[model samples]
Target: MSADDTDFLAQRFEAHRGHLRAVAHRMLGSAAEAEDAVQEAWFRVSRSDTDRVDNLGGWLTTVVGRVCLDMLRSRKSRAEEPLDSTPHGAPPSPAHAAPADPEQDALLADSVGAALLVVLDTLTPAERLAFVLHDLFAVPYEEVAAVVDRTPAAARQLASRARRRVRGADVPEDDRVRRRRHREIVDAFLAAARNGDFEGLLDVLDPDVVVRSEAGVTTGAAAVARGASAFGSAALTARPTPVSRHALVDGAVGVAVLVDGRVERALRFAFVRDRIAVIDIVTDPERVARLDIAPV
Candidate 1:
């Protein structure tokens, strides 16, 4: 291609850069890796002849999807830490990282919830690619199949499985309702404790409930209630006001305590009917970070 032709192609590629980056980010869950994937796609596209390609945008999207799929599969094979291994609250390194962009980060967090990223990490590369491209981006199954090397029907199935996992399809509709109710009970118990309402806390706790933590186990409703009151008191006196929010802990309703906008710990619960039968406190930083947490 002549200089003019090359410049024209570059402009066209630039137009699709943001979209391609979004696709790669959703697939890879890392800004750095997404940038690498988009750059690789540009390299391939610029080297190829596109004289007869009618839909340039569609063509570019598919190219990026294919690039992302390869990156995901390679990541799986390597069995290494994710490319975006910045710990939950650590600042990115200035020497090796792109300039900070809070606006873009917030947009991505809104577009793809942290919980969804956790679930996507559990999917196979093919399934993740099929779901993100076809379900999220409205790419046709024909194109999805081409990218994942599966039949259109197979590609459809891959996305279906991924969709099911993302939506917690393993849980029945009735069970889901019950889970929500459990969350409400948990929330109420926390509220009561925060306000030092012993009766309200007892109303949501099973008589034989067991509470386990790194400190030790506290059994019986009355005993647990007293402990919860003390816990709440501590939160009230802490330097920063603590916030309790419900989140999904290993696919079930649970509570997370946030201090200064970071998850300090989590409380996983087991229910006997409508009341909380067990409370397992997770304070280990690593374990807390791995929990499947999302807004309730």
Candidate 2:
């Protein structure tokens, strides 16, 4: 392709970049990996016969979906067990971590709270790709089938099965009472964490829960329970006065630990079936300072 031809194609690709990123992120559950997937799509798009592609957007979306599906399959093959076997709850280097996005954070909290990603992890790669494309992105079933290399009928079935599972595990986002219940459950969890009650935590936590903190990521109910026990030691004094407040951290139900009006730690909890599935604690100074924490 000529220089100007390549430039024009690049500009056209840029138009779909944000959308492609969103699609890939939903499929892969990591923004970084999504970028990589999108980049790969761009490479394929650039080299492919553009004339033969009647619909550029649809073609690129399919390519990205196929790339993500392959990646997911490779990851699954390498794992000792299933995807839920280990949540990516490991401690992060805040200094090196990408700048926080409150909108994305809130969305993630919602996704995790509803166990959307956890449930998505359970789905077969074809089913996941089919569902995410057709259901989430409004891609037609025919296109979805093309991406997954399945018949249109099989694609519809894949999406149907995925939809049923997601609906079962999904939280009621539309219900005001359900929202209130989420806050109350999280508040109780915070109290339990403060009181050094391991069993209490276990009561609220899912069997395969994960907790991420400055110390490290704690996976499994037993380890998370032990960490809950350790948290109470510091809560004796550091959390004395008002205790912790249940607030909306970045527009999601989260607990904020304050020391004299300053947020010391932000606890973002994801509830699955009204039980805690993931606990992400952010103690980084810069990120904590950016939180929009308000009482429930």
Candidate 3:
């Protein structure tokens, strides 16, 4: 409240905002929710008496942990309610799946990816909070325990369970290997599709290859020809031109599209065993403005 107190809080926020956001995002899987949790934590910190707290960092972290846990618990309860209670013919689009261009996709893939977030969502709130804080952020068990209101041993157990679940799922290899394979697969797939070489594209595709679009479209290898046809048709209508053939999205290979020398689209590929396992295309027109992408 006082100038000195305000300055101290401001300094703390500057020092720890990134760390807080990382922990919250990993737990909740929503940047918007993570930001809200951080703001709520700050509000609680401001109302407290700082003089009584010896370790301000630890105190703030605990506040954030508690806030995130409370939010997760509320969400879980809603999920458990009867379906009729919550109108649900079809799920709404995920918030994170905004239409993205090449630049936006490139930037996002490095910091966060859809596959990784899906794995994180399998965890319970407590497990997510404990694991992200202790494993990802390297926060100690004792400190993390305080945030989740659990004993250190219990927090350690929660994190362990969460770690096992994540590790059990398949993860792409190191950045370098992932990128190399991604480029190889994307190039092969595109070339084959362009030439109407179904066998060529099939050869490069994994047996279970999947393609997803931000528009809620999904297709597998069995339907790849149809999917590719749709994409090709749209490409013609949109008059897409390649701005850059090779770019990295989170260290994975991506293709950039430009219209009038400005970035208009970005497509990222995921590879498995030297085959194209997944392809993500983002065509959100707004992404150009949000990412400040320059036209080729």
Best by lDDT: 1
How displaced is residue 287 in candidate 3, in Å? Answer: 45
**Candidate rank order under lDDT:** 1, 2, 3
Candidate 1 vs candidate 3: the lDDT winner is 1
| TM-score for each candidate, following the candidate numbering | 0.52, 0.50, 0.48
> Candidate 3, residues 1-296: lDDT per residue as tens digits?
67676677667665876666656666676666666677676666666777777877777777888988888888866763211211233222122133323452343344455566777788888888887776555477898888777899898888878766865667666634555656777777777666666677778887777676666655667577555644553541246445455654322356766677766677666655567666666677774343222111
RMSD of 2: 16.6
lDDT of each: 0.75, 0.72, 0.63
Q: Residue by residue across 48-105, what tens digits does model 1's lDDT show?
A: 8988999998998899888888878787678754444343443222222445356765
Q: Which candidate number maximizes TM-score?
A: 1
Off by over 4 Å in 1: 79-101, 169-296
Scored by Cα lDDT, where does model 1 land? Answer: 0.75
**What is the per-residue lDDT of model 2 for residues 1-296, given as tens digits with 9 covering 90 to 100?**
76566667777777777668778888988766776677667666666667677777888898899989888889876852222211243222112234535585455445533356788888999988888887566587889999889899898889878866765575555545666878878767767877888888888888989887776877998887787778664732255453577776644568887788777888777666677777777888886785556676
Give the lDDT of residue 281 in candidate 2.
Answer: 79
Model 3 local distance difference test score = 0.63
RMSD of 3: 17.3
